[model samples]
Target: MRRSRAADPRGRAADRGSRTVTLTGLVAATALTASLTAACGGGTSTDTEGGNTDPKTLTYWATNQGASLEHDKKVLTPELKKFERQTGIKVKLEVIPWSDLLNRILAATTSGQGPDVLNIGNTWSASLQATGALLPFDDKTFAKIGGKDRFVPSALASTGTAGKDPAAVPLYSLAYGLYYNKARFDEAGIDEPPATWSELVAAGRKLTKGGKYGLAVEGANLAENSHHAFVFSQQHGGDFFDSEGKPTFTTAANVKAVKQYVDLLAGDKIAAPGNAEYAQNQSLKDFATGKAAMLLWQAADTTLKSHGMKPGDYGIAPVPVQSGAPGQGRNVNSMVAGINISVFKNSDNLDGALKFVKFMTSDTEQKHLNSTYGAIPPVKSAQDGGTFSTPAQKVLRETLATSAAPLPQVPDESKFETLVGTAMKELFADAAAGRQVTEKSVRDRLAKAQQQMQS
Candidate 1:
């Protein structure tokens, strides 16, 4: 995630916007990347990674959850060492990159050679569940990992589709928050973070003076674009799919959502024109380096610190809503974002894998790992007024508990992220070129995207 996402620093090291990486990782993943296209349509194989019959040994695949592949290894080696000491079980770990994680998992699902346990993006729970590759956590399974009550209710919601066994368990809980430069706000005579959409635009205008921009947007980053699009659509009372799981990309409220988000650049002029092509952590860089006064990001504290912007340099607040304060249902400002850990159904070491999951989600490990990554631990009791008590974590925690909503638990959800996200990317490019991003233009783009799905 910069899984917490793309090449982001250690908090989830990026955002759900980063997709399947850190939450950024590398290695074996190279081979998996090569066969993703083929694996998608391949018939399921009875083959599995059943080589290691030794009861004490297990294999694990983890998304890069730190500043770099090496950083993740450095942080995890010690924990694995500790785990090895406690139980004679040894976990051979392979860190996979975000760009290749999904492909690899798909390949594994098709081939039945996936590791005993691996991390997945929470949003992908339903899609992966549809594959039947992941081990479902039923009531009995939950009992293996300290019971379902141990995790937060909100965090557990994204584990899979409703009325089914969860394909995974929440590992690191994340939610979007508006991160603002305090000095810039204070100098601009702004007192508090924006509460409503109107106030956000107004505050942005004040911070948009001089060479520095008011807000940083990851316009070309498909996942970031989709995450924001989803949140905005929710605030506008829209859904990407109907009850039958059909794409509803161009609904009236949806069109409004895309327009409002895109208008941050096209209509408002608060974000920089160059932001249209930012797929990498360039937006995060802008916020960290003082080039932008505000950023809407997930678990960005550690990443900002990596850029030398300390905790005191910025303030975190709930992402603004369309009208009143942030809340459930319509007024949702953040999507439930984070990583989920799951065991493979074909794992040779099922018992060992379950033990590993229990160990990883243990109260002690949750505090240790989430603290290092700057993510809020999904385990309810893991958060014990320590590292998570800070203002940033506080806001993210509150948002997840109250305002955040899960992405639609449909198999086409990933497609929705891609199509609408790409459409928004195109709209941002048009805006960068000074094109009028009107209602018709927005609807046209969405209609085309929806058509791509329906066809």
Candidate 2:
């Protein structure tokens, strides 16, 4: 019953190699915070009627990776210029917010106004691949980019579903980690971060004092709820879907998993009720500030830095499980989190787009880009040493290699995130309002999601 790990809609994804779970139940991103909705409509001002076909020019849609959109532009500008100088191909880069990227890409797919190249959450790999809008990296295409072996085997796994050519190439790799406020832990006399869920709760109760909370959760964000739901379900040895990919969301284990998570607020009373109002990135803010003592996030080093948290302010550890040490199955700690570089199949400048992907995946670019963003490079060589060998990186990298699992590789994986995550959101709302969050209540909500999916 127990299986392995996996992101945000703005984006989360990971590779599933030898440890791949054929089970269809585990489909949700604990990857970095992904915005489930796009706030500002969709589409850029230009690129209205298909992409720029100019052989020497290419357009790329980059996800928000830095402290702010402006920061990303500052980081990527010179890199794009460097690529231009090397290949004589000009890159038109648009930094899309995580909030609207998926919708914008879908709009681009339907209207054919997308860019030549773009980044996608690895969680969307199979779903997007099913649309047949992305270029497939077949053996021939893999050869074009220094062979398929050039990438970390696990990162490559999230590129798409099994037995098919990857719909994209892994660029920046990530995995979830438990980040704790060092001083808070020290003040509480907790010598180390939590190793088990029970220990986490005990630590949380001790940390909850003076109007501050022990933990934070993006309780209102559907994508965030869905991710934790999937993760907690994994710890409880439950599956959201059966082997044939049908909804199985109301299992006993599922109820137990959902209850435990909600009980953090309803039962244990560690997380604040205000967390139920958190949808954007407030949980992150809460942890960055002193409002909360701990946070579980996908590669949050850069974001923490942006929030004015000094490097030594916090420490990273594996997300806690029910019990035992983290290895796989029940011991698995983090879901795969990463971004993928893809070429639109309809692009007029496919060559340039492919070249751009190759360039980004190159060891040099991977090093600079991943290091700059505090993300791990999916390229095997780039992951070997250097910045990736740091203390924080070692935690994330080890998780990806040994414990990280992919979300379901189903075409409708995104829908699972939406429906189930939303269902959990409503439950949290009820909990925040002082309503009883019972096992039966959790089951009823999940059953409704199952019915909606069937409908």
Model 1, residue 171: displacement in angstroms?
0.2
Off by over 4 Å in 2: 1-6, 13-53, 326-329
Positional deviation of residue 82's Cα in model 2 after best superposition, in angstroms: 0.6
Cα TM-score per model: 0.90, 0.89
Query: For model 2, how does the per-residue alpha-carbon lDDT over 196-244 read when each residue is reduced to its tens digit?
Result: 8899999999999999999997776666666677778887777787888
Q: lDDT at 99 for candidate 2?
A: 59
lDDT values of the candidates? 0.76, 0.74
Tell me the deviation in Å of residue 16 in model 2. 20
| Count of clashes, each model | 20, 12
Q: In candidate 2, how many Å is residue 440 off?
A: 0.9
